[model samples]
Target: MKAVCTVLIACVTMFLVPTAVAQDARRITPEQIDRLVKPYLDAKRINAISIGVIDGDVSLTHHLGTLSRDIPNPPTDQTIYEIGSISKVFTSLLLASEIEAGNLKLTSTVGELLPDVSKANPALNSVQLVQLATHTSGLPRMPANLDLSNVTDPYATYSRESLHTYLSSIDPAAKPGEKSEYSNLAVGLLGDVLAMRSGDDYDVLIRRVIAEPLGMTDTGAMLDPSCLSDSQKSRLAPPHDANLDANYNWHFASLAGAGSVFSTTSDMLRFAAASLDPPDNDLGKAMRLSQQKHAAPIGSGVAMGLGWHFARDKQTLWHNGQTGGYHTMLMVNPKLNAAVVVLCNTAMGDVDALAGQFIQTIAGMNVEPKSFDEALTVPAETVARLAGQYEIAPGAVLTVRADQSQLFAQLTGQPEVQIFAISETKWKYRVVEATIEFELPDSGPASSLTLFQSGMKVPGKRK
Candidate 1:
């Protein structure tokens, strides 16, 4: 009975509002921000919220909710949140900085870095470092050999040996630079490669070269176990589950570049600000270049930057992350000196979407991008006609149905999802971030539906 929606429909219909209208460059008023953000924070069992709204040279910061519901500890702008994959942008930038320093080259192969790189297997000795970083190396989401017993503590046991063995048998999904498929193993491996090449620790290199230079005091892989005082630990927000149980923590150190960076809203906002400005340090410019598109286009009007998702209409750059209990979002609107960073301690739904709505409101755009509900149409019979199993890719089947007044879909391997009818023909779902549109074909079939998400679309033939 529990379902996750596959696509987020807002980005497609949402248009940007010009921020040219000059307003006072003060922090966003609490009243103005509360009006826009209070709904989600209040409705969801959010543990804590830290939001930084930067406009012009001024930034308004808010610390809402509590670090723990049982205890009454309020969060401050200084409270750190584990910024997941956004760390990838930083790692990629480190690689770029190495490039600028003539210490590394983007074109260098992994084999070149570790010529004797046969840890768990032999074939891995030849993989390229760039391939792993950009995720064009045909790696899975994680190591193929990893059989995590505890889903919550999944990566706790993934070892370097096992990773090397998987790489030895690695069969690329796409060639070295064919397509963009996100791979934690790939990016993490790139981190190892960087460390191997530099003869310095990955964490130390990132800190000494990037974080310290940018004055991002709270941005790093792990907080000193000693630094977290008993009060601080007690004040730390625990991640939430649907049943309100305690969840697990994410491991980025073992898998370094993939997803392991912890940071606070203030630090992230500073990172975004520095990212928008040209790199004053060698690492900064390299970071910008890493976010620049490298391979063929993957999503609609979007391309894969070195490690981030590149979207254009107004050249908006964004990346979001979801670990077990946390959701993080960071976006930079370079055109406007404006950017939004939201960190929430909850596994509830699309926190990024919620945060983006607030950002949209702050930018004077229509905050509530509209979508359909199940009962909006009375013709379930017609919607049923559009229901059935659709095969979009090899070994992938998307099942659709019309129940009562709603149209629903479930990928063959996924649970059933109720699709919101955006229009009679177009439907949008959840964080999977795709769209399902029904169309009438003139000659082939009576009515057909096409699947569009990110940038890929496949039409369903009548079956």
Candidate 2:
């Protein structure tokens, strides 16, 4: 079975590297970076990792690990990785650009842009463009009608017709603009509407609206091999699952706006620089507008601004994304005039925490890493008793299983990882700073499991 671990364990342990010499925060040496990253790579057994940082006048990019275990080629700054939901930021940029040009407005309804959609469901008339961008349109996280035959590439078969059908039949759990929820469907719809207004497909719209303006030549929804030099193509990092097995790249016919862009660390750094200090161009103006606070999707601490999420305390604007085989993070602190981009080819590494630590380090802040205790002895029978599937959400499930003396967990569409027992009923994931506690009723088998992570308690009932 594939070992899935948390991003925290992989990212924090690296920052906790002990050093006798006091290192200069302003000028971090490449050797220091390698020392911090190499151990995490070794522990997780990850393939390739590329990190880029922009701190004031100091800009640095480093590539570590091999492209794949089979091929010992090291990745470079030009290595392309699928930057899933980070595409939302680009789609919102398009919205801002159109709004600036008087072509569209945030108040513009989905029905207004796509007349055929209104004909099918008049309810769509109430769903505004801003709602889609902010994830306040009351849309579900995904279409319930999605085909699960190919779990690895879930969105490959989802077409324009499928989106319309799902939208027409959806009974939103909350009213439009009533609550803040993350929705890939909502943002995908926003991209489609923007494309319709621009008289271009999602890919072309992004190139013209955001990529071309910023000179991010290599960043786009559909990257053509003919357009790239042989050297650049050779640097492209192949996607890998949690098990370190080769995974196929994702394709989206209609939902391409949500998470279909392939880009390099260099291109992303350019994009980050533009976001930090927007130029006088139209795209720059739109980029600034996209960063303005719109709504507090999850009630005021970290608010949503177009596609970006604001960390008020950190004075940072950032977004993270994950594809089937890759995990990525891009963060910028305009206050400090610094930004960090972390890209990993393997799905298992914790690029999120890695980027956070890099940003914090650039800001000259002290970071304290979390430590884990040794697992307590638990009998094989006790672990087996807790092994079962638990329903976390309507369609999301977490499956727990025992492999001889060890226990593991597998989330829907995620890889399985060995979980260490903290007690008979409580366990911890070594990769992340999270805990799972199994509830046993006065009688038979385990009834439920509660997952504690990121200040949320998610309870899943055994099926």
Tens digits of lDDT, candidate 1, 207-248: 777789888877666323343445445444576542234665
| Candidate 1's TM-score | 0.75
Q: Ten residues in a row with the worst lDDT in model 2?
A: 1-10
User: Best-fitting candidate, measured by lDDT?
Assistant: 2
Question: Runs in model 1 with CA error above 4 Å?
Answer: 1-28, 117-128, 222-235, 242-245, 299-301, 369-463
Please give, for residues 15-128, the per-residue lDDT of candidate 2 as tens digits.
222212233554544665676676557655468989899877888999898888788987888888877778888888889998888888889998887677677788888888
Q: What TM-score against the true fold does each predicted structure earn?
A: 0.75, 0.85
Total clashes in model 1, counting residue pairs 3 or more apart in sequence or in different chains = 11
lDDT of 1: 0.62
